[model samples]
Target chain A: MESQNIKKKSVRKAGLLSLIPGLGQMYNGQQLKGFAFLAVTIAFLIELVTIGIPAFQDFVTLGTVPIRDHSLFLLVKGTLQIIITFVFLMVLILNVSDARQVAKQYNTLGYVNRSARSMLKNIWENGFPYLLTIPAYFVMLFVIVFPVLVTLLMAFTNYDFYHIPPAKLIDWVGLQNFVNMFFLSAYRSTFVSVLGWTIIWTLLATTGQITLGILTAVITNQKFIIGKKFFRIIFLLPWAIPAFVTIMSFSNMFNDSIGAINQQVLGLLNYIPFVHVSDIPWKTDPFWTKTALIMIQTWLGFPYIFVMVTGVLQSIPDDLYEAANIDGANAIQKFTKITLPMILFATAPVFITQYTFNFNNFSIIYLFNSGGPGDVGGGAGSTDILISWIYKLTTGTSPQYALASAVTIVISIIVIGVSLLTFKKTHAFSNEEMM
Target chain B: MRGILSSTKFNRFFSRFLTYLFLIVLSIIIIYPLLITVQSAFNASDLTAFTLDLHMHWTLANFQQLFTQTLYLTWFKNTMIIAVSTMIIQVIIVTLAGYTYSRYRFKGRKNGLIFFLVIQMVPTMAALTAYFVLGLIINGLDQYWFLTMVYVGGGIPMNTWLMKGYFDTIPRDLDESARIDGAGHLRILWQINLPLAMPMIAVQALWAFMGPFGDYLLSAFLLRSPENMTVAVGLQQFIADPTNQRVAMFAAGSFLISIPIVILFFLLQRNFQSGLTAGGTKG
Candidate 1:
């Protein structure tokens, strides 16, 4: 027992030994793990040095010469910087991983020489989940993290038209961009109006869908409802189709001159003959645009609600309704007392997600209107949500990367705040049903 | 024990009739556009004008023209390449990741899950700038492999959790038995857990396949060459470009695009529903 104890180090010494890559493993007596980390570090440094030298040389040769044309210097430098950083991070993570593995082994076995065959078998059994996760981590880093970092950095810089790559150098502008967005009246108004519309759009779309969805679920779940299964399937169909397809089809449907809804169906079923179909301003009028967006959103969104509510509805046992019936509860009374509560309880977290989802429901607005009538040349639309507005802000005239980043920061704050709130309210949001 | 209406001794058949009438109207409201589009795909005349007039000059000429004129076949080929490649890579990655999270007690298991969750909340659009830059840096953005990489990355988080959830549902005793039988981790996962989690695998693959198909924005922004465009982007270009503003072509093209997904949905709907139900019910 004393000899076994001699093989393991205290946790404090093990932690302190992690200052150098894989040293913790060496401290924990894991010679192989420590060696592997050392090799990886050396290899990464070698690779970085190899790629970086030429890049530095290119940058020096092209130093401060404003050519107004493309050069390989910026590309090379950027590539080198990314590679160095990435390699650096990979090493750090790998070292930490090695240390953690050593610590785990030390906890159990008191030494790292713990038979390679058993270790291999254990890894073979448990390695799949780790293997699966690594790609996702890389992807999440590249796609989500890298871009977000770039955007955040761009917020502090003047990376606009003049600073376009291969041209004049753009320096850091501090919080000036954010100041301009907030303090400048023109920017503020546009931001406010666009934000207002986005809020309205999210509310109307989500509320409309949820209300109608619940109502439909209730009706369909009722006893003696013929073809209930058929209705449920039909209701779920809209959601099954791609959002782009639905929006594109609906956009065509609502067209005033050439639209099927305006011309053939509405014309044929004309309860009011005086209002000509050709004169309808479904896409043009601001009121109609907002209405059209809401209506289209409802069509796209209701099916999700229908599907969720169906799940929630089924979870409400038959005995509850029977109990309600015995208590002299009418249909509406039964719904209020039993059904709505059960559905709401089960679906509140989903409902919060619905709110956040519609907050960025870009496909509908972009595909439907392109946030249009051009906002009467104001560069936004009556139906433009915050996400589409941010998109336009980035891609539109003058290329407001700084302003867009500020907008993103604000959006991040709101989203995080809402997420925390929702998580607090529903344990499911936090617990997340881990497999 | 009985029908509410029948037991009332007062036949409120009018309300039932009205409800049916309302539902029928609503169903038509939902279904009419699809019906119109299907009809227009067959109509010989140009449907670009978006006319309400149901001029039923029925012909398969639009479908015939689509085959003759466009690179529908090329687009189909490219889409299949992207979708299939993405599915293969994504399934392997997600399945492994899911198994790890389910079975292993790693240091950052909670943190990793949180990271994925927070990352998922960020819009895909947020990554466009970095993605474009990364592609340029690596010289990979324009290639088929690059798109597949992006697809795998994009699918990893949600799909991993989903698979993890499935793996969680699997009894650990299976693993114990496999281990006692001298099966390795990979062997157990491949031989036992994978087959048990086939529904999730199908769902993951289906989602991965559908991703590259439905995406227009990413493919459009990233893939510079016309040859690289997926069907969604290509078809949209067909509608938007004046020379190819053939609306009937769009319909026909959409019909073609819809085929795989429709088939996918029907074939996997039962499994998909059961997976979803299991996910919801377990939580």
Candidate 2:
């Protein structure tokens, strides 16, 4: 009798393990896990039986529906579902555990009869890394992955206000939402217009911010500049403060009636003959509303550019500048030849991201005007971006869930397309030394 | 003589004067809004107008009313709870993921890294609708953990990138030496890697702490019930509550809210700047 027990399962057993959820564990000689998996299956089956009966009765009869909130019942069902889900997860984990143990035993001991103590020890030692990853996996799955999947599913269904709950069944709608967005009468024009405005807004705001930011950084970084530190800190405040506060503060400043920008800053400054006054209409007017958004965005955005440029500026070898200077390069020539190219190359990815970010910049636009002056006739505000429009569709009084889902898919496609193009072209991602 | 006249002393004097002038101008730009906010917060008026003259007539009435009349405390408590929980969860997860990505040469390491990078590029709006539906599902489950999970989820990718980059900069010899000393991966991470990554951890903590503090969209959407309202969402009620257009209260609230962030900014600015600047454009 060999000391190392070389026990093996039949092919049929292996096939059975593949068929059943936890049979793999039992085959690997973890009976407890297999039994636990069976128990959870039974429990969830019971729960489904319990909830399905009445829910089915109400749905099929359609004459005399249950006259209860069923909140408690739903709660119980939800809890059971969660528990079942958890147990299913546990079974999965145990299967993996058993497989790993079996593999390790085969490798190290050449047998299936490794002591439980040794098994436990191996798990304790090598398993911590795997165990440590559980939270990350759980968070990503439940939080990001689950929701995204659910929303993707919802996009395929009629989960609008009319189809809230028990009263109505949310049958699949296919690509009707997308169809509605593109060609349908209700939203086609509004969607196209809002999307156009969004693109324009993103372009203007991002460009303005980057332009101002580079200008400020250039000016401040100059040897001749005074109070460089002070200017730097001042410029950085927008980045420091929560964006909500900055936008809110500026919105108030740009308010039509009592806004300080109008009443004080501009009111005082615009009195001068050279300055074009005529009451800038920061909020109400279409052109000025967009302008206000751009200005505030510029103010908020420039700081990041400043910081990035500053870093790039510091890293730029002084020899390049010295060489350029020696070659009789004027300040403009030197900046054009050396500074501009260097910073652009270093920050091209960030520059592209800024555009995409502004494209989806919901917070500022929403807070600034709630995408308002409402698109009563045109369907969205002069300042309304695609993101805000989506927000309106989702949270609007009518609650256009299907439409919102369509918008989401559209935005995702656009973002994915743009990012892929950039990634492929610049290989900006190749430099992302992830870890 | 001319060269001597243009010496270090003269240059220093000239620079000093310009510095002072620039500082004064920039300080005004930075400090003016803050002053206005503070003044507006203290003003006792029907309309919280930003009038210098009116602002001069400061009063504690706005703060008094905020404490006395509104759900400000509840909002504060909610915001703090959310922020703190988010910070803790973020630090733990980011710390783990970051270290793993930084040190471990696992099979899916490159794939995972690129996945996170692309995911990071996916703007909040793209995923937001999905998140809202997620919230509803979780809310259906009747758990606060669901919303917390979302915050933690959104934060992990960015913070992981940040912390991972920071971790990569830490010398690998420490991990190697720890392994030689009979410490396991977790033990080494806990005992050695984490301590070295503290500054980056602090940066992660700050951003996570501020996340729930300033967020409005998710909180507003997810936390439908008034009792669960964060300060950011609660503050919005002031504007939407047409009867109570006490814009001063919003300003007062804004003023109060800005404190922790300001302190955080000043305290963590060094780590924040260094962490972002150095790790952001890794080649």
Tell me each candidate's RMSD, in Å, in order. Answer: 4.2, 5.3
Model 1 chain B lowest lDDT segment of ten: B274-283
lDDT of 2 by residue, A219-329 (tens): 677676655766766777877777787677777777787788778877777768898765677777777788788877887788888887887887889999899888889
| Per-residue C-alpha lDDT of model 1 across residues B1-283, encoded as one tens digit per residue | 4687576644557668767886787798787777777677787777674443356888889878878887787877898999999989888878788788888776668888777666656665644555666678778877888777877776776666667767777899989988999997668878898899898788778878887876766776677687777887777765565354677777777777786787776677666655654444333
Q: Docking quality tier of candidate 1?
A: acceptable
Q: TM-scores, in order shown? A: 0.87, 0.83
Q: Candidates' DockQ values? A: 0.43, 0.39
TM-score of 2: 0.83
Q: What C-alpha lDDT, on a 0 to 100 scale, does residue A246 get in candidate 2?
A: 65
Q: Can you write out model 1's per-residue Cα lDDT over A35-109, one digit (the tens) per residue?
A: 777787787678668865655554444334556423333533544466466768867876766676667766776
Model 1: CA > 4 A from native: A1-18, A22-29, A43-111, A114-128, A272-279, A376-378, A393-398, A430-435, B1-12, B50-55, B171-173, B176-183, B241-245, B280-283
TM-score per model (chain B)? 0.88, 0.88
